[model samples]
Target: MSAAAPYAALSPDVVLAAVDAAGSWSDGRLLALNSYENRVFQVGLEDGGVVVAKFYRPGRWSDAAIAEEHAFAIELAAAELPMVAPLVIDGQTLLRHEGYRYALYPRRGGRAPSLESRDQLEWLGRLLARIHAVGSRERFVARTTLDRATMIQAPMRAALGSDLLPAHLFDAYRHAAGRVDDAVAQRFEAVGPVRQLRLHGDCHPGNVLWTDAGPHFVDLDDARTGPAVQDLWMLAGDEPMMDALLEGYGQFRDFDPGELALIPALRAMRQVHYAGWIAERWHDPAFPAAFPFAAEARWWEQHIADLHEIADDLF
Candidate 1:
């Protein structure tokens, strides 16, 4: 696992000062919190209450991205949608400290639910529908939806046309890229209107929290306006995964043939990206259970094979 450098330095004084400057907390004690890509700390105040401070990784994201997410969360909440709203500090939703932008949030209660319950799956679908409903009102970001070619081509392109991926992946990427148009077009026509809504770009099971109220969504860092199918695509699985979710989601929203058509390819894209990321981070002990090494490697292998088989049919 290649983790980035830790934030400049984390301490109670630094955290308290940041929160105090925000006017939300007068005086608070800070406790270090755990995070994968960002720095999190639990700030305890004189009144014995706590707030979570999330500081973004310096090189990982830009200030604009952070602010957009914070604003989007408030928008969602105002629209009666599920989101982790961020606290304003120093006249900015994101606080700049130690060369990193941060946000403070009152900790909410929730846990990941076991997949055994149908109701839970239904809740996931309904909550996702509500997220889509509110996000579509405005253009949150440009080019929210990513076509298959862009996924396979962009990184390679950035690598200066010098395929840095392993040999095995080269073939898979090439195969997918060659016929990207047909697959994307098929999906667009089937799914209808591209279903572009401001979306939680990474709304997998792990991002969802089964709170006392219902399924309360957290982790809006990857939130963006994009194809709504992208959310369902990330939840791809055998019958248990799709059956209830599709049924439940349908109750809140309907998908045209175009959106439905893109489901499979989009699902494949999600799995491909996830598998690649997990494979890269396989050595990290903290990589979530969902991306366990053995299972992920197996999935990646199968995905490569699937890519090979689907190559000709994509177009």
Candidate 2:
């Protein structure tokens, strides 16, 4: 497809033409399946095989980020971790056509599991443990980790200062919320208490697929070295859920209580970031209804009222 063509119009001919440009793709029927920040299509070839074609949006990410993801996938596969191995066509790790980055992965057959499933949640914890163990020092990409002040306060202050969010709300909550900040800092200072490891930076429900073999992780876009708990921080609340996650991981080492204590803080930060992004893109016609982020914003406000409640709980 030409760079000018709407990414949705990836016909068999278009798919072949683009693939053939690299002298790699053939006889594939491209199907529409993805609708998010990136363009994705599923290609079913005449040979009875299928692959996912992705077209990335350009912004904070450069073409090199796409290539790094390809390299990381290879490294992860080499470590025998369960994941989708990416194909590199032409001299590019990802196909660049029409000014967008693209790549294909063999389709894995699986069902989407409910995010609330204890079994799946536990399995997810273990899966993250295994992925983090995949050693890397290639400096392929910037690592993902918990940097509370930068990831939370600085951007939040900017957002509030921009007059995009209600300044009064921040002012009303700031003093009470200061306790969360102090707690977070204290935990970080006593770093001996948290379990640190590599992480799948964005291991939400969608990134995980349930297959007969087990759970296969997809989309290593945010993969990075950081605390293993980063994978589960967003999945907090509820005792059974927390227990299941830790139990499924099947092993324990010294965990920093400080790192785990940051869960509530991280939760609030994620909701703020997500809601702000969605509000910024509210004019886009394709935004999904899956995230009720406005509700989350309200929840954070309420949680801030009792931030001290989480001061001692690490689970």
Top candidate by TM-score: 1
Global lDDT of each candidate: 0.63, 0.60
Worst 10 residues of 2 by lDDT: 1-10
lDDT score, residue 39, model 1?
66
TM-score list, all predictions: 0.73, 0.71
- TM-score of model number 2: 0.71
Task: Provide the global lDDT of candidate 2 against the true structure.
Answer: 0.60
Which residue runs does candidate 2 get wrong by more than 4 Å?
1-17, 20-28, 114-122, 135-145, 153-197, 235-237, 250-258, 280-284, 288-315
**lDDT for 199 (candidate 2):** 56
| Tens-digit lDDT track of model 2 for 214-314 | 77778877665556667776554566776677776655333344556556656654544554454344333354354444334564466455554544441
Clashes of each: 11, 6
The residue pairs that clash in candidate 2, if any, are 3-98, 193-255, 193-256, 193-257, 194-256, 195-256
Per-residue lDDT tens digits for candidate 1, residues 41-94, read 877766767788887755545666666787788988888876779876556787
For model 2, what is the alpha-carbon lDDT of residue 197?
A: 48
